[model samples]
Target: MHQYQFSLVFFTVLTQWALGSILMISLYRAATGGQELNNSKLTAIALWLICGFGSLCSLAHLGNPLQGYYALRGLGSSWMSREVIVFGGINGLTTLWLLTHLVKGKENLQQTLGLITGVCGLAAITMTGQIYYAVEHQPSWHTPLTHIGFVSTALLLGLATLALVLRQSSKEMPAGFRALLTASVVMVFAVTWQLAQITGLELNGVLVWYRVFASLMVGCGLLVMAKSLNLHSTAMVGLAVLLMVSGEIAGRMGFYGSVLGKMPW
Candidate 1:
């Protein structure tokens, strides 16, 4: 379905924030504590590439790139301003950390940076959700639960995708890959539970979209578990990737479609 341009733009902004935040933390987790996670660096590198490209595209959508420098002016009054700040800071910090890891060949410092990236990345998406959550006039967007929903969707999708991509490169993987799969599936369930609670509140179209999206997310998790149980890690990971895409896309659509007029403003 067609969406208003700005609405599409806003959705993209939040997506970029969510994906970047999830991956940063995951990479750091792989590398830290001397885990010696094969393909962890590759995941980190992919995080930098995909998320960075999305960010650039986001920036390009801006009409006045230089004016973006003044974006934080509304921090006191605008959630968007806060989003810009978190996005800018975490992106910059993550880049430096990722680069340092590459050139310096890893260190405790990189792990520290990873921690920072994860926290900031999650915050950035939280800020994105708040960008709407603060709109007290919009009931659908006004709930604090929206924040949880946004973050959960991001984590589930990001982790599942990263897990899927990594498993593709090699047959063997960290012992935690299965655990990670479990955690991601749990996240999907959490999101689905929340969506059901919000059902019938959104427009019929939006509600239908959310149900479909939410179901697919849940199913993806189940599929992963099934494959994993059958000792089919490769298939499970591949399906997880598909599941993540469905969940993220459906979530963004649900969010946009749920939007309605301001409360008599």
Candidate 2:
């Protein structure tokens, strides 16, 4: 149970990184496709840091940490195997990213590594959640769309935290702000839908936290937008931060509370 709690925290953080990676690729893809954004470097970096660190924490949960390397040998048969491989790649690339930045971004080696890292980072996050989705026992966990919910929340929290970090960068982010808030709202709705699917699964404490956090997330997003529109950026920031924390707590509780058939709590 304690391990599950730790894993859930790691999973949440990893998923956020995955969301940031997806967003980064999407933005880059869009720009190449003639679409545009008011890109925020600070926001992007913070997301990378938190998500990357979160993914690395999984190493703590490995029962036989040394043998963890051999897990990737099974990728041919399972996504979990690929996740192990990808998480390693994410760490390696993050090391490269740091080195590249230290060298004033002139390292082509780092540049290439960054691209691979970005892809694997998202893959790690997606597959982390997908691990449960692959389980055929727990119907709540077996939902095909659960992976999307995990990915969406990652984007929401990643962007929100990034926005906070960007405030210190002193950069104007009109388009970035709009896009992130919109995504945040969408994430809240998606969470609601997923919870709806699990209405009365005999998981009371877990569902209670899930619904509470889902509602908190949505309510907070709305409040932030409403306040921000009324010339209250401070109020919006406060609301957003509160919602993000509440959402995280809710998510962790739900993850820890729910019992899988493979591992009864």
Candidate 3:
């Protein structure tokens, strides 16, 4: 992989993680009729900060950071340009959503902002996936499986991290939350299986396997243990989050490596 591509790996993964977190939290809030989550303000602030950090990583990925805005000039024809615009919009919306949480008597406005942010986030993430999927030179990334894998990463990373965040105050995991956790884990395997079918297992690298082990094996194992033991230890959940995040990062590295290292130049 190109040395500079690591910045992109962080950029894409972190942005998707934040988008997913915001989406999931928004959906949960909707399901519970805007029931306020414990520490929601803190969560929103953390997510907004994460978006800022991811944006910085994205700028770093551009060797000439000052020229980064020039990328927007391609908005009419480039998926990357669209991605830049959409992500920027989502970041602004996230800030507004976060601000709504800061003031009292803004639950209605907060929920509205959250839902709007979630919708824009989905579009931004799709644009991110499209950037890779449109790269015809990288067969590994050109497949629809690429889109699925990217979305799955967002869901899995977001769900796992949110579990850790919410578990901070709850004594036991809610059934609904557990079910989402299980569903996200299932998404991890489903995407992996799809990738094997799309591009044979042999083409997958050690980093890919590490991703599988970390996100699916160790991460899910911790969740299962928590359920079976009826425990909500932040330590266990936090460890799971760490493993899943690292796993996704490794997986993303494998993603770019497949294109840069194996392509016939």
Best candidate, TM-score: 3
Q: What is the C-alpha lDDT of each candidate?
A: 0.59, 0.56, 0.79
- In the range 1-265, model 2's lDDT, one tens digit per residue, is 3524666566565556445543553444343442222343433454457656676566667778778777777877787787777666666666565565446545444335545665666566678678878877676667755676666665565455444433334333357655765775567566655754574545545544554554354545454454456633544554665566556556545544454322553
Higher-lDDT candidate of 2 and 3: 3
Instruction: Name the weakest run of 10 consecutive residues (lDDT summed) in model 2.
Output: 34-43
What is the Cα-based TM-score of model 1? 0.73
Q: What is candidate 3's lDDT per residue for 54-166, written digit by digit as tens?
A: 87898887779898879989988899898888888888999899989888887678877877887787678777889888988667788877777778888887777667766
Ranking by lDDT: 3, 1, 2
What lDDT is reached at residue 186 by model 1? 64
Give candidate 2 regions above 4 Å deviation: 1-4, 18-49, 105-120, 199-246, 261-265
Error of 1 at 105 (Å): 3.4
**Top-down TM-score ranking:** 3, 1, 2
